[model samples]
Target chain A: MKKEHVKIANREALIGVGLVIFNFVWWFAFAYGLGSKDPQEYTYVFGLPAWFFYSCVVGFIIMAVLVTIVVKKFFVAIPFDEEVEE
Target chain B: MNWESLIPLILFIIIIFCVGIWSGGYLKKSTSFAQDYFLGGRSLGGFVLAMTMTATYGSASSFIGGPGTAYNQGLGWVLLAMSQVATGYFVLMILGKKFAVVTRRYNALTMVDFLKQRYQSKWVVILSAVSIIIFLFSAMAAQWIGGARLIESLIGIEYTTALFIFAVSVLIYVTVGGFRAVALTDAIQGSVMFVGTLILLIAVIIAGGGIPNIIADLTAENPNLITPFGADGSLTPTYVSSFWILVGVGVVALPQIAIRAMSYKSSQSMHRAIIIGTIVVGVIMLNMHLIGVFARPILPGIEVGDRVMPLIALEVMPNWLAGIVLAAPMAAIMSTVDSLLLLVSSTIVKDVYLNYVKPTASDQRVKRLSITITAILGVIVFIMALNPPDLIIWLNLFAFGGLEAAFIWPIVLGLYWSKGNKYGALGSMVAGVGLYILSDSFFPQPFGLHSVVMPIVVSFFVYIAASLATQKKTV
Candidate 1:
């Protein structure tokens, strides 16, 4: 009974939330999982600590690209001027 | 005093003033004065929509306080701050087309207007207006103090003088031009922030003799500095992850931000904004915090955290270039201030005044009242900022938490849940705000999570329970 645009928005919102959870899981895993190790035992990637490089640096790039793809693929553009059915 | 450094900032202010004056012309030509002045007549394009959201959200904290914390906490704070990467995406997508179509159908100009029409309750509108006024006053005061302090230090002038100058610049543009002025200036300011952070990061890395040497220096100083647990091991994974609520998902509730969802021209603009806003927020946030962590070796033993950004910029870059680069923070502060000012003004003029004070007030009267209220609000905030509290960052954060707790459930559940009614909104807001204050004060950071988390969680249940309990009566 809901409008098509609202249904699309609801689906897109679920994807958005999924992406957020994915981002947090990705961040938390690399950050706390790899990062909890001792500093002397740490590795480096591109001059950043291995944990930070993976968690923040790589996390940022992956999220950006993933978001772009998700929006382009899954998200549909609905008209703003359409009337809402009460 | 370095005259070279002052030129770019002064020029920046001059250009902002010109934009304000230019946009004011549209205010005159518009058919609906309130819509044009408050929401820009829904004419925003994709790029401007993205930039305005970025610039408005990137306040003094992101530009100044964030880096300073990064300096103190090390790489962990950078990880913590990255929780904000999905802010614009969450706001635009979750609200998305439904919010825009519904608001247009209701003829809602402000977030409170949407709430008012949706709930059909006088109390909901009043509570929303009051919460916005109270919380945003503190937020605006924080911005005012930050702007003054930035100008005071950069130009080597007295704090009072800097405050006066800063107050005048913001008041004139916002009072004259309204939301269009805020959005256009935000576009300019957002660009400045992007380019400025990029330049400063590269310069800081170079000054530190490359990233490898900087990491080495940090390791030699304290191995903990390179870890994800912060310098003192206080940034627990639990606490850091909880920020996903405070800065990440809960941001959709902020009136200054939520209103952006209603202002874009089309779904194409919204689509474009989600992509652009996500990337820009990522780039600026990562670069700024990284610069903070990287600056520690170059300028060792800085006492205050807020001073880290300006001091590092001056140290790593030439004065003239530093001046230009430093405009990013200034841009951040002003953009936030103008948006908050206009928002608070509209809350009073559109929501409170028109609804209660005089429903039949003429358009001319309403327009005049909005401009006057904006200017008056600026002056009041300026005065409050004159004797600044020592913990301005905490003040800003408190405002964020308070606003989020008060409105998050009501706005979000109200939009999606058909069973959500006025009683449910009232219960959720009262419980959320009351519990947030009690927890923030008496039991600070229960279970190693930020204070905002519990209230938001509990409020969700309160909203559902209250709504279901009252469903039959309303029906």
Candidate 2:
């Protein structure tokens, strides 16, 4: 049981680090990869330029979907303890 | 003056006051005033928790200043602002179970309470409180100015009278209802923000002759307006990317937002909030900023970006509807002000005065002190806000950077890493805050990144190095 507890703890930490890295990569790509451009040179999409479309609209949609999936999948719900009688 | 517009705004304020008064009844009957006043007895459900987090985090900057900046910077600023979509998710997810469990075990009332317990160091508590009071004064003042500005623009009143009205309204409700009042009203205000942003965004797009014509006008005027690069080409890759740190994951360190993570009643509520809060924040942020960018074509050449939200709403919609729409920004401002006011008051009364000065004070004394301190802090912030800045977003962001730098590692590492000790937390805060202020003053955007990035990086290293160096032998 004690070893299992440590394994869960290690898994939680691993997941935490994984999410952090994912977030970093997400922003890094948006900011550095697609972001390093002159808007005058880029193609526009739906009144928004490609960079704007991909980064803000697409990025927001992806984040919303990703967050929902991750929460439902990885976050195990721990029931709250019943209120202690004073 | 648009009297029609003012009527809906007046009605909105009246509704807010009613909510405040309604919550005050709860304040009266709560068994422990401290828990009820500060954390709302940790009874916030999923939706309320989601809205309170959204409302508190979405300040005047997100509503007024953000749209204003987007108007100027075009789509790039909108892209930058989207970084905040993950804010509520990050806070609730990263700190969700652990924060709630530990803070409950410790019976912690404030963020400072958690820190003091985690570090087991007096210096950590004092530093945390001082950092909160100092930085949040600017943050609170920024919100006060925002509320005052929106009122001034709406009713055709002078700034001081508007400030007075905004200050008094917030003080009355927050002092009367405390955290429960703020949390409940935040639910109402968050909904306002969501609906209002949608209405105004649709209206702005229609007013701009639809998306196609708006795009044509924008391209004809300045091609960069539709692109990721800002109008001035100043929203550089480095600057925009680094901003994610200031507003995104770093949000977990913000005491106002972080406290919400601990206040929810159940893990199911946390899970629900994680979804709802992210969706609400994403929609509101995207629509509001898009309105700002889209408004540029409809209401061309507005000088003050802060006035973009009000000016565009009035320009696009009818006076009555515009009044209702403008209420969203007002709601945003009031919700932010009330929360910040309560947070600083809790810092002083619960963290400092109660901990150091009178640890044994009776519940009655503590309640009186908390209310009085909240009122006084409101007045002090009012005085500070009289001379309003040109753009309140900068003030708000400055405060955000300072707080995030100081508290991020201490809070995050302290939670995850058992080896983290008082020496590390103290060193982290001192180094983080001191370096942040210095960089912001002198070497802003060091290496082309936001001023906050450097301090956060430096503090992280300092925290780890100091912790390892000072680790005492465990018997």
- Which candidate number has the best TM-score? 1
The numbered model that scores best in lDDT is: 1
Model 2 RMSD vs true structure = 2.9
- Per-residue lDDT of model 2, residues B1-475, tens digit only: 7799999988888888999989999888877889899999998999999999999999734532599889988877887787777675777767767778778878998999999998888999998998798778777887788788888887889999999989998898999998888999999999999999999999988888888798778878887776666887777777877877888888889999988888999878988998899899989999988998899878888998779999998889999999999989889888988998999999998999889999999989988898889988888888878875544445455688889998999998988788888888889889998899889988988999989899999999999988988887321
Q: Please tell me how candidate 1 rates in CAPRI terms.
A: medium
Query: In model 2, which regions exceed 4 Å deviation?
Result: A1-41, A80-86, B60-64, B387-397, B473-475
Clashing pairs in 1: none
